[model samples]
Target: MTSYYTIDHLPGRTIQLDGQDYLFFSGTSYLGMAQHPAFQALLAEGMARYGTMFGSSRNGNLQLNIYGEAEAQLAAFARAEAALTLSSGMLAGQAVVNWLKAQGFGFIYGPKAHPAIWQDPSTSLPTVSFTDWTDQLPELVAAAATPNVVIALNSLDALCSVDYSFDWVNRLPDGQEVTLLVDDSHGFGVIGPEGSGVGALIPRRANVRLIVTASLAKAMGMPGGVIFADPETLRAIRHTAFFGACSPIPPAYLHAFGRAQALYRTAFERLQTNIARFENRIGLSDRFQHIPAYPVFYTEQDQLYSYLLANRILIYSFAYPTPADKPNTRIVISALHQPEDIEQLGDCLYGKTG
Candidate 1:
């Protein structure tokens, strides 16, 4: 029988697991704002004002104003025309896919596309891999039976730590238009200025329409998923049956979300500092591409994983994309981790101690 260890306190860089404190490096809380006192205070204020749960459908007559406020703030932060929040990133991805299918758009998914984007194969239309799609993009666009075609991919792959630069947008054949649907969950709140994500790195173009979906639960240290798009696209998505049918995220989180923007900005700077320190201490190899803001480090060796775990460091060890093969151990760094903690980890990895 598989046994699970019990967590005794709130999660931070250090966590109490089964009565023992361990340095944790397996969480998605990149900015480490989940346990921030100020953020927690905002959460408490939200709870006091809105209670624990709204427990109502988004399309219902009774809707919280905080939801609109939070979305507006999110849009402003992301520099998008509009933003929408849902219960989870998976649900948000499904809703977008459903809307795209309804509009008769065929999909070309990247090699390392998230499973959430293509979960329901039955609804997917003329879906193809990125390589295949790239090889036949011009033909596909010219002879597309649908109104539009979409290239769906992640902004960054956690396992490989590679940023999908979306350079193909510029290389598209003249007179061909394709929508770019990106899941920026890994990049959001970690990369770009003020944590605006991959969209900040890539400028918008007239020929391409950019749609981004992300989960706030990671770096923002908040719950729910967010979609950033133009006002017209948002209006259309809001009217979708899936969007209206699903229950909205908690009002407390929405309220806290609006109030936590400044905090997120502050945390982002510290996180960047921590990342720089880590990189400086442990020199990265040129063999693998690295994103400074992304804390995950992937290695194929199991000895390193075992050594870290033996020293009470809990890092993520699993397979790439899935748990079938190609084992990868992921070591995550966060702003919550102290400089000494980073130094200690560096020592362990590089055998350097003073």
Candidate 2:
């Protein structure tokens, strides 16, 4: 079939996989409440009050107080100086790249950096490709014989696992003025000990300026992406053609963020515990097959994804049309997930196949 539905032949929570309806386990829904009652309630309230789309930039007549509140909480939550709510997380990436280009900075990227970070910037930066950016980063930069570097980080990638004694952000080349941008798309609210972004987990490293951006689509279990940075930088982008020209979010999404912030801390602790449980019960200790995160164990992962789908279970998988090589399949634990769900997924992954 040219098009597909959920594995269970439903929408949202379910999507078609391998010719059968299955709970979509292959997307980033860390809190797993795409259909939560509160979400619905807020959505209805927003529809009644603010309509579906904001229809203009936040600077327009509709200075959505809800959107502003979400931005504030997001900045506070990310523990950054400030935040800007983008229509999407990916949009955040696009905006950032544009900003860097305007700054007239040359960029060098980690091997596994997200496509949005460097690939599209090919027209721009003096690029360097490395097998393992963590190991080759300094050497490659030293060899490049250039300065004015911008390092884009996707924390889940293996290149940045342990977070070291502190973080790689600090270990950046000593005399170079580095602009370290971390797209904590996967790490926000999910990996850190607190619901705070991963930036909070690691001690601030030297000359290690941070700019984090993430989609609320995943761990926030809602739609849209929020970009966090200092207020000055964010404000400067406000009038830029890219950001200033676009419509803002619907009131419904704004409401969703308020609800997410209220519940985020509790959900974080629950998911962390579940990760601990998955590791403890299976008698296995490892990181995700492709990315670096807590208790996302395994490798050679297609078999695991297939097994999960066949049993009517689901998780995020970066298989198929998205990218053929990266085994992006993932099981996102949620506050809504029961302890039993964890057991079942663990058993399926760890159980002996006779």
Candidate 3:
């Protein structure tokens, strides 16, 4: 069994373990907003105005204007007709799944999908690879009794650092009302031309409806989730008990998010620079699997994980979500990494000291 280590503080460029500091190259803080000075200042400003938390139901008699304003800003940012914010990304996904089930849409889950979008814990999904699943989707959709279908999948497999292509949507047969229920949790603030995620890049069809749900906690560094959809679709979801009964994300975070657009842009630029520098240092190597412009790099060598740790560097190396799952090892880069940090990591990677 793999034993776990404990940490007492938020992880940044470095982390302390056993009274020793190690270069921390693991985590989902892709944009490094959590430790960013300017962003933190904005967050402080928001808290000063909105306080720490807002526990009131969104449908309560008293409503905060920040929620609607943030939603509108998010919708505009994502290029969607409308967007809904939730307390967590998991809630956003479950809300969408519940709505899909109520509409009687049969599900076809894609590869390595996160559990957040599942109909339930026991819902059995195809065990085949993503390519095989896509190859068989057309036939399955054509044979189904009902035309309403929901394809639930992650935009990318973050554990393995694989970027899934959306070209498969173009091959789906017409006449079927297909809803692409994508969990863009990993891609939301990291990829796409404007950092809007994979939703805008998916192929659009007359019969296809695109619905994207994401956790803003990752790259966006917000303690919330969001659902992006067409105006009618979003309105229907908004009316659900799930939306009204649940408490919204802290008004303070949304307040900061609404005004931090330029800050996000600056962070993204820094992140891109870090990625380029690291890629140049690592070069082309078969020991790792990676996607261009993405922050995470995956490897199958457990020995490498141990090696990095021995060098006083820490990277992701553990089973995810469950202990039964295969262990994953990934080196995550972020905007918080200074050029010197990258150089030190490169030295360690090349078996150099100092």
Candidate 4:
């Protein structure tokens, strides 16, 4: 019965929950820019200029200016050659899957493929769940039913527990034009040498074509999603139903996006400090046992979720079961969270299973 609460404050890591406010270590507002005055002003100004809803595709409104600039800003921010903004992260994911399917290619995803990947209707492709992308060669070789293999993965919070290294990605079998769709929603502004997060992982590779997509709700603390890749691939994806049929995002949002993308590079160190501080303080070394992803605290999720809710503290739980994998929950962390919030969350979990 732990319901989510919203605050008048911008979408930062920490905020009010019900009448009680806690340092929000949850959700994807990794760098705390969501609540920054500049970011907030961008949204406010955009709203004043363009109103809330565009309500139509590029056809009627021709608001391509906002889109193009945002795409450019995001590409530079994400270190991608180009980018596409989608209505939602899930839609962006579905867009790629649908497009790949329509092209008659096979996709072998990590064992923990986001549920939407499997929901795709394209049947001519092969889809496999990879538990360990680097070590699961036998599984992939045995499972792949087609020559073309497309892999959709999250860099840090991988659906599978794959390491975020170009080394393994380079090890990908040759002669196959394997398109790698990496979801860096969580890593975009928080990790890596430059706070480029997952982008820090890609520049080293030459063999594979890479595509990055993510939801702004998580890290940049916005409400939409971004697709990053080359212009040709982006052009190809734009023709899909999810990309073409849907209405464009409001022009006002471009401000938040622009500010977030601008700040992501500078804010990486602060976010990393926040991450390291929280990790050092907590002693979950004894109680939790699930695949590790960034600063997320994962374990027997369902029961932990119910237990924490009954106790009044709230958290998100991830529970996609892989092949031969048992269900679990993940406790996602954010940069805006204060030291106190981590202590409270630690007490909650430590008290439960410890």
After superposition on all CA atoms, what RMSD does each candidate show versus the true structure? 3.0, 4.4, 1.6, 4.9
Q: RMSD to the native, candidate 4?
A: 4.9
Q: Residue 147, candidate 1: how far off, in angstroms?
A: 4.1
Candidate 2 local lDDT, residue 66: 85
- The best candidate by lDDT is 3
- TM-score of each prediction: 0.90, 0.80, 0.96, 0.77
The better candidate by TM-score, 1 or 4, is: 1
Q: Rank order by lDDT, top first? A: 3, 1, 4, 2
What is the C-alpha lDDT profile of model 4 across 1-354, one tens digit per residue? 233355676545545656665444345555666666777787888888778867777544355578788889878776778988877777777777778888777766554445444436442332442334557753574468877677766675433223455566656665556777777766666555565557657744455678777776666666777777889988988866667787666667876676555566555555566556556655457445423335566554457666776565556654344335454455666655666666777677554323
Per-residue lDDT of candidate 1, residues 26-95 (tens digit): 7789988788988889999999998988888888887778888899998888877789999888778778
Candidate 3 structure quality by residue, lDDT tens digits, 146-253 = 779888999988888887888989999997889999999999988887687887889899999999999999999999999999989988888899888998899888
Q: List the residue pairs that clash in candidate 3.
A: none
Winner on lDDT (2 vs 3): 3
Count steric clashes of candidate 4. 5
Q: Best candidate, TM-score-wise?
A: 3
Off by over 4 Å in 1: 1-6, 122-147, 286-289
Name the TM-score of candidate 2.
Answer: 0.80
Clashes (backbone N, CA, C under 3 Å), per candidate, total 0, 20, 0, 5
Pick the winner on TM-score between candidates 3 and 4. 3
Off by over 4 Å in 4: 1-25, 59-61, 119-133, 138-145, 158-166, 203-207, 240-242, 260-267, 289-293, 301-312, 317-330, 343-354
